[model samples]
Target: MAWIMLLVAGLFEVVWAYSMKQSAGFTRLLPTLVTIVGMVISFVLLSAAMRSIPLGTAYTIWTGIGAVGAFLVGVAVLGEQVNTMRVIAAVLIVSGLVLMKLSAE
Candidate 1:
């Protein structure tokens, strides 16, 4: 249950991050509102996950999920440039996350 909450929180982190970019530094109204709401929900879920998960592990996993999710969104939806370096970095981030997950006892 805690892990599920953490995953959802991470997904919300991606939502907020993408919405933030669309918000244009908060100049846009709807996207800005979405960003604010998503941010709040993500933080709330993260806090809830922390009740069971260790702070460092949960934070690292949450951020790793967000980073990977946002990067994929940028490439797929936002049409951001993708190159070998970007792919490699993303792979490294995911690999680190997997390692962390395995190491968490």
Candidate 2:
């Protein structure tokens, strides 16, 4: 249950990040609201998850999800350039997360 909450929190991190981008420096009202709400929920879930998961591990996975999800969304929706090195870095982040999760189990 805690792990599931962590996963959902990680996904909320992604939504918050994406909404931040869309918020246009907080100039856009709707996106700004979404960003605020998402961030709050994300943190709430993260705190809950931390009751079971180690702080360092949970934090890294949360940020990793946000980073990778933001990068992909930027490329797909915001016309950001896709580069080999960027993709490789994202892959490495994911690999590290997987390794940590496996080791935890």
Best by TM-score: 1
Candidate 1 error regions (>4 Å): none
Task: Give each model's clash number.
Answer: 0, 0
- Model 1 clash tally, residue pairs: 0
Considering only N, C-alpha and C atoms within 3 Å, which residue pairs clash in candidate 1?
none
Best by lDDT: 1
Q: Encode model 1's per-residue lDDT on 1-105: one tens digit a residue.
A: 999999999999999999999999999999999999999999999999999888988999999999999999999999999999999999999999888878877
Weakest ten-residue segment in model 1 by summed lDDT: 96-105
Candidate 2, pairs of clashing residues: none
